[model samples]
Target: MTEKLNRFGMGASFVPAETLNEIDLGPLKQLVGEWESVVLTQTDEKGVSKPLASGWNVISVPGVPKFTFEVIPYKENLKFSTVAVHAGNRGPVLNGTQFDQEIFGLFYEQQIVSMCDTDFCNGRGFGKDTVIHAETGLLLYVSNINGGYNIARLGTIPHGNAILALGKSAQANNPGTDFFDVISALGVNLDGSIPAMLGYNDQISGIPQFAEFQQVHPNTFLKSTLDTIIGSGSVTDMTVLSMSTSHPDATGGILNIPFIQSNVTATSMDATFWIENISGGSEPEILQYSQTINLVFPSTGTVTPIIWPHITISTLKRMQPQPETNEPLTLSAQAQSNTPGVPQL
Candidate 1:
């Protein structure tokens, strides 16, 4: 017989050790199955900014009996424009002719690992630091070789299957702006003699010809996918280092984007976005718009536990001039919206 502690610490009780160990784990076991989610990220370097949604999932394996984390990103289609001084002394005018451009794209399928001590004790884990470009459809997969071990592969999965799945979904979903395909098809089209002067004509004129630009389509690119399994206890104790944007173009002015970090013991998640204005002359500004959403996880077994308890935070920031002063300046503002979620896990 085994002694059982009273819930209120008032009654004396005894129970068999074998009975205690025989407790049904069906509920927890069902909750540990494989899962897949998608996240959407959008950044407007032009002027108008949008929000990025990140998706997370956890899966369980038979042998290890641990949890593995996977993240997938979807890109928000953004369309906005800003004026630029083509020639010298030109006044600041709205250039509606500028083709729609997207500053950032959907994130790649990244593998997250759980670091553990003694394979099940206490440890920490981090996600891979690589990002996939939405426009060029290029996958810049970075491994442990480049002075960074944030993301590593514990095993290998079939490449053909993953590629096929990624391609089919990316094409079927078409999660980009309406004009994304249009602008991508027709690159920066400049008027006047500029195109010719830049030697963009045929060989006879010493100018370059617009042969097939060999534009990289959005669907052909493929990113690496990896998975890691860690002990169950490791999931409860998680920390977020910092959330950031990937390689941003210099064409747009200053940009500020807001992101949320989940599973954080702390109540707040902080994020910062950096932008460099290579458009020349003036600097850019950042404005922030925020919103929140409630999330609910599906119930599992008899007594299902809520895994994600935090609210989804979204923000959008851009560069603009001071309304009152009418001076060339940068302004940053923040807005927040909140959503509730289940409080089990």
Candidate 2:
């Protein structure tokens, strides 16, 4: 029998140890599936076609243009698999109360590919539809010792950087303005000029020849979809999870390898995810996320270290439900094992 204690220390509920499948995933249950970006297209009166991709990335790099800025349109596939349920955390007993906690975690893999053709955005081409970014991470659903709940992300990037960010979760009727404002205020337009927020005193140039890359914020792709859904009165439910490397209530940050740290050091990261349930749409569940990473480029002979924002945003539709398995989880070994602080084996 396993005794489940509540935050109040009032009573305990006992259940058979074999019933490990009966788990509460909290709000993270909405993310349990495979998702693919919802790519949209728009054509102007002049008959020029623009691909409003589901994913967009804006970053500053070095090239023939001194400080070269690239706006990348991309497609992404993100898959989440259930890793564990009811992962326990033994808490301390303060005075007379036990502050035990449990976690439900999901492991995710994200792959992003460029949607650009050759010579479209300078010769800094990632090739036609080539893989641009890949990441593996874990999303944890945890119960805070004090009261409510916490959501934490453990992500490993192939760019020699690792991140751990923590924050609270909310289920709301509509997403707050903060989610839209931050991105709109800082997003780079397609005119080939960086946002004023970038704080570059000199005139920065290198606008792509295509109008598709010239007139929208990275998050505008997501907002367009959201606007259509909201206008249609189809949003039945909304869930928002916002996390950051500098969360006030938690200790979280990013770590970079020596090579990356010496050049483009990732200083901080902030991301927000909005999941909505549409009553009648092509897909029942839609996931939208906006992530911004701050990077510092080391100074050369005359230039000072420049802090640039790398932003990625996407709107994804759940393509499939979580993986189904008939075999029960092997929880006993982990639940009953206790090795000393200093391991002998």
Candidate 3:
């Protein structure tokens, strides 16, 4: 019986998700439970996959995780909550420094995310702006997604264990340093005082190249190459939503850039989830996904596109069912936060 209890985490039942500033969790309500999470694989030397810390046993990584439906009141008509694992845990690579700690945990493979009205309305973002034409209690699915605020989640259960993947994003074509020459080629700059960048800075919009990039792709961008099993499971359902090109990269994968920001990118993100079944069965869900952000670097004096992708895969089991009174959560990657360069609320 203890073994069975271990399979199903016990943290969820203890947390209270009844309300946050009078906001309801909506479709995401089911996530208020415990789960057995595992970091199954990481990029290997040959570009293959291997266990995250093969050197260590699975017991050290922490299995059972409980998620709390918490939120922050940002602005009018925009309220949100956070859900993540590791309760103050840090990654192995942090070297004990606080860089990959606290808020940084949200960006981890299994980290934080928010749920608002838009996720329920079919991936279409509904923040301070955007008119979501919902009829009384009806929802319409649209193709256009925009909002500086966005979320991508990969939920999969491999071998009866769950894994969550986060697809780094580019709110818009935030050109950074690599494009200085390109910016110069456009013959546009507020003044010659500005320097090259690795990521976007809203205050520096005086530059033509910077302003134009945002105007060109004014939304969260994403692209997906869903082949087969990213890790394991049947891949019951998966969706890659929204994509925009950063000048060089959205993910900081290109570390060798001139500046310390990040490269332009076409990010990929996972959308939403609800318990697929509750018959007390253990079936795996395949999870594999990534996004594109055109990477340009001095490759032998020339430049080329690197397959820079943020991907994850895993399997999970339903250790616990959604609270009988708990509502299921829904998510869709149909929008980007209009206020670029700001995801903190």
Candidate 2 per-residue C-alpha lDDT over 1-345 given as tens digits, one digit per residue, 9 for 90 to 100: 123444535343322324425766667777876899985778889999877676777766643434555666778888776544345667889999997776766767787777767474425646446667777778887866623438888998755789988877887764432346335223232343543544442322334434554323566656666765455556677898888888655688999989877766787888988888776555577899988887776333424566666778888888855446654332111111221110000
By TM-score, the better pick of 2 and 3 is: 2
> How would you encode candidate 1's per-residue C-alpha lDDT over 1-345 as one tens digit per residue?
112334443332322223433332211111111122222224466766553332221111111122212112222221121111011112233575432211111112222221111222121122122221111111111211222312111111111111100000001121111211111111112221122223222222222121111122211111100001111111112111122121132111112122212221112112211111111212121111111111222222212222222211111123232223323212111111120111111
Question: How high is each candidate's TM-score?
Answer: 0.16, 0.75, 0.26
Q: List the residue pairs that clash in candidate 2.
A: 190-213, 190-214, 192-207
Candidate 2: segments with Cα more than 4 A from true spot: 1-21, 44-51, 120-122, 146-149, 174-179, 184-210, 213-216, 229-231, 280-282, 298-303, 322-345
Tell how far residue 331 is off in model 1, in angstroms.
Answer: 17
- TM-score of model 1 relative to the true fold? 0.16
- Per-residue CA lDDT of model 3 for 135-171, tens digit only, reads 0111111111212323323222111212222232322
